[model samples]
Target chain A: MRVLLVDDERELISALAERLEMRGIQTRWVTSGRQAIEAMAQDCFDLAVLDVRMPGMGGLELKHRLAQSCPRMKFIFLTAYGSEQAFDSVATDMGDDFYLVKPVDIQELMAKINLLAGKEDA
Target chain B: MNPAPRSLTMDALQFSGTVTAAFSHDFKNTLAIIKENTGLLVDLLAMAEKGRPLDPQRLATLAERIGRQVQRADRMTAELNRFAHSADLPEAQTDLGAMLEMAVVLSARPANLKRVGLEAVTAPPLWIATFPFGLQQLLYRCIALLLDRAGSGGRIVLEADDGRPPVALRVIARTAEDRIPAGETAPTPTPEMTGLAHALQIRLDWDAAAGGWRLTWRDVET
Candidate 1:
């Protein structure tokens, strides 16, 4: 499966992408939303994991843009401040797919990726 | 009763009131997460009782998450302790960059909830002699205000310069709101915020032009 990780924290993003790679997922990581968009233009990604906060351009706006530009790309938001209400607001188009909170368990993350990548249903 | 001293005392009380309220609210959220995690563990145990063996790996991951949350709670308590004690002393030498980083971390959790970015512009560490917690509290309140007024896609910029004495820290509120809040008829500074700058003997300047506010302070003579 092809995946792209966008997080402002470089170390965290690198570590996460490495973990995803170990599970046989091809991953591309970037620190900003703009970079993620650029990567999208260059190649196709089956999934996009976005950190909800960044300096230049943040995640929610990027999500909006991605929906318009690449409708098929699946999204999974990872944030330290994940809350039920916050998820509820974005639950329509991306209904409960995967909203992993920060310090995410690698196993759970892999399981979610499998589901989104259509390798596993649950 | 004469209103002069009463008003001053009332304002002081209000400042303290707000600080405590914010601190308690932060503590509540920390504890709430731990509560939910433990509840999930309890559910896992119940499932095991029904001949459904809980995944050992899942249990281990959950335990680690609980441990991490405990550490987060510890850090919050430590910060609260430092802030509480800061009220006792008049001044100290604190790294301005570190102070801003702390404020960013504390604010980011909530800001991330609304999808607003609370970030510090990466720069050299700036140090200044002042009440560390007071400055942090003041900046935090401003960020919180901006987040409330801003939309989901807004970003706050925080910059600090150590080269200049009374090191200048600039905060730009980029979110759009042409006028101040409705009930607040005047632009008078909050006494608590004003007194903090006054206590440091640093001039605090607030500019409302250009759709944002700028805060600059003069360092004390070494």
Candidate 2:
């Protein structure tokens, strides 16, 4: 599956993209929401993984923008905040599931990705 | 007359929570980087088992990356530890430069998040005897207000001048976009800023040399 990862932390996102590519998934990464939008305009991707907090535009805001632009794209949020309670208190309407805490286990993340992406396959 | 900080428990808690949350997020990111690097090492080992030779140099590089992240985490914890103990004594001694530097360091994550640069440009070591926690809290609040208004690529400079008795701390901000350029009627101080300054018994005024606030306090024992 083709995926796009957006995170302000360059090293974390770069390493994640490399690992995903190793697993035979087409992956591209960017460090900002502006760049992410630019990239989406350049290519088509099945899913976008975004870190929930960023400098200029946060993940939820970017998600709303991306969803408006690319209706078919899927999203999975990544946050350093581990607890569900803390995530809920983020002062936003991002209450939907499919958000993962940081230091994410690859197997668990991959499982969630498959579950989200698999629905389209069927 | 000094206001009792015990009466400002709610304000103090909020101030502490703000710094703690920022530090927690930073620590998590540091840990996440370490984990990702370790995963790469394991992947390399797995590839070696699959008959592709794992260059020792690649393993060494990953190990080095992990080491740097660990050191970063260590420095963060030490900063947090010092901050946590700041409230231990209502009054404590601290170097003016050191105090300003700590405020700059602590506010860095939040400043970076807003695409603002927070820096300390101090003259030299100037010892001051004062309520350290209250002063620190005041500094953070002022920096935060600036960060909120700062646009992308803006810079805020913190400078300290010790006149021996009354020390002046200047917070000067230069925004990429033209913001209230230094003079012609400065914006009125926010109520929150006024309250924080009053509670800490420090004077907060507009510093129009370029743009920003000037914080002054008297230290008889300096």
Candidate 3:
């Protein structure tokens, strides 16, 4: 599956993309909301993993912007701030399908991705 | 006689909680990076065992990244420790530069989200016996006030006047749109805010020349 990772940390997102690529998933990464928009213009991804808080633009705002342009793209929200409770109150068109906190366990992430891919195929 | 006002207590709790939360958030970011880097190392090792030769440089870079994150986490821990200990005393001999530096660091994440560049331009160690925690809160609020005005590409500078007695501190949170004409009346701070400043014994004023808020005090505390 093709995926895009959006986060401010250069090291974290690049390493995440590399790790996912090793698992046979096509992954692209960007550091900011602006770059994410620029990337979507050039490439398509089946899934997006976004950091909830980032400089300039946050994940929620980016999600809306991305959703407007690419409605079918599935999303997973990651944050270091707090629990999924932080997102529970926000009215999101895309609910936290697989909300994960920081220091995410890769195995669980892989399972969630498989679940998403299966949903897409079905 | 009535007891002292509770604004200090409430304000202290609110500011302390905010700073601690930000520090915890920053630590999470650092830890997340370390976790991802280590996971990468594991992936590389597992692949190498399956006939893929390991790239020494790649492994070294991963190690370096992990080291850098560890250092980042360490600094955050030290800063948080200092911040927590700041409330231990109502008045203490505090270094103004360190105080400004902490304010800059704590305000950085939120300012970045607002796309406002926040910096602390501090000189030598200006020492004063004052309420460290309240001073930090005052500094934080001042910075936040300017960040409110500073839009994208706007810069806010927090600085203490160098080589000046009764060292004045300032937060330049004004955007270009904030400047007023000479004949026009400048905006005044709300009475409630002024009361809080009075409680903190900080002389707060709008410095048109600095295009932000200027704060000076006589090392006084209740």
lDDT digits (tens) for residues B1-222 of candidate 2: 644444456777888898898899989998888888888788778878999987988778778888999999999999999889888887777787888888988898888878888788877688777677877887887777676555578877788875555777887777767464443566566565677777666789987665788888744545
Select the stronger candidate by lDDT from 1 and 3: 3
Candidate 3 lDDT over residue span B22-82, tens digit each: 8878888899999999999999999999999999999999999999999999998888888
- Per-residue lDDT of model 1, residues A1-122, tens digit only: 78888877664576567556645789999988889888988988878888765755667677877767777778887755545465566556555446776656667787888778674233
lDDT of 3 at B62: 99
lDDT of each: 0.65, 0.80, 0.81
Q: Which candidate is the best by lDDT?
A: 3
Superior candidate under DockQ, 1 versus 3: 3
User: What's the distance in Å from true for residue A57, model 3?
Assistant: 0.7
True contacts kept of each: 0.00, 0.64, 0.88
First chain TM-score in every candidate?
0.84, 0.92, 0.90
lDDT tens digits, residues B1-222, model 1?
433333434554555565554555455444545554555567668768988877989778767766876787798788767657666655777777777776776576557656676668767766567776667666765676666545466666677755566557765555434243232222344555566556555555654543234456654532
Q: Which residue window of length 10 is worst by lDDT in model 2 chain B?
A: B178-187
Q: Is candidate 1 or candidate 2 better by DockQ?
A: 2
